[model samples]
Target: MNLALLFGEDFVSAEQAVLTGRRLAHLKSVLKVAEGSVVPVGLVNGDIGTGHVLQLTDTQATLQVELPEPPPSPLPLTMVLAMPRPKMFRRVLQTCATLGVKDIWLINSYKVEKSFWQTPWLSEENLRENMVLGLEQARDTLMPRVHIRKLFKPFVEDELPALLKNTHALVAHPGTGTPCPVHINAPATLCIGPEGGFIPYEVEKLVEAGCEAVHLGRRILRVETAVPVLVSRLFDACS
Candidate 1:
């Protein structure tokens, strides 16, 4: 539940804040929060607090709350992803949010299905919803900024450099190399390909644009799968 939405007069303590919105119902019905319970409380863009249930009425609930420790910072990576199918896009967006990507670019690719572009899930509202789900799941409030690029070369040759001002740029491709290097101390820009992966020409253009082409071994993973794998593997390597 969003702490900003909690309302009432007697909610003086962290335990007295009552929730009456959809979240309250979810907790009472699904989570089975009982009277005198203390649950996780958080501000919309602030630290997590404790919600102590002082009273529970059919229409309202109260708690005592305070925001203490701050939420963790976002991962220092900018993800450049080729637009996948609509369903795939939803998953990818959420995953990117949970992984704390600094930014996301939904770029066009040579292998991108023309019909996939027509999916309504690409609409702003739908995309935002997926990102919210991802943030909530990860206990993160900040949303990653997202971009769209329908053209390939123009984006790589023109816009990418500025976007990646101080970031180390890398593109995820399949083959052999030292494997995507472990997370470095600095921020990074990672480019992932379309379903069948980036064509050689597309890869070459990106390489010329200052992004190093890196591999994840021989196994070609789906776009949705490659993302988290790369994020964790690279970050863990550096950690």
Candidate 2:
């Protein structure tokens, strides 16, 4: 973990916080921090700063926290994604977070397996955990918002229009004529499909909802690979 992400529960007082579990293990094994050492720390949905270790032990560590710097600016992008395979879902979610995608929509697609939604990684706790891993990797603290929509048609017809408002909307399809735009660096909504890509009817629905069908060349990238590539291509300042 690059930054120790502190939740509200980690705080004992305004300026003091405690670390345990994975973070404590990281401190002991990875950082090898002493009681007097300072480590990079950030509060969830708050700011980035440093924590001076006041006490250290095998189980926990206490630190004096000071947060004055704002986290990196979130990407003005809304990601509408087809639910990926259970095995890849966690990694995709983490990638989205690491790319600074604050708005994420995990919607159903024709190729998406129904069982994909049953994965434990979709649970609130697991989602937060994976996103935390991503945030800590990026040294970012702002938590991303994930919206789940299991019904594809209803989501496209009812919700997606408003979601795409005032944004450059595009859907990444494999064989589409339009290449995915680069360095737009403005508000955008991007839709990506499952392994085999979205069916024609689903693509039509998304297109009807304001997304322009676009492609990332002839290569068919996996959902996990495509997410970061497309995000970086569209935005200039992810870091």
User: Can you give the TM-score per candidate against the true fold?
Assistant: 0.83, 0.98
What's the lDDT for residue 124 in model 1? 84
Candidate 1 residues 1-239, lDDT tens each? 32223333435554445466666786688667777777665554456656777668888766667667565577888899999888888888888987777589989999998887788887888877677667666766666788888989899999998877788788998973747887674688899999888999998898888888889888899989999988887675322
Q: How far does residue 50 in candidate 2 sit from its true spot (Å)?
A: 0.1
Model 1 accuracy (lDDT, Cα): 0.76
Candidate 1 segments exceeding 4 Å error: 1-22, 54-64, 176-178, 237-239
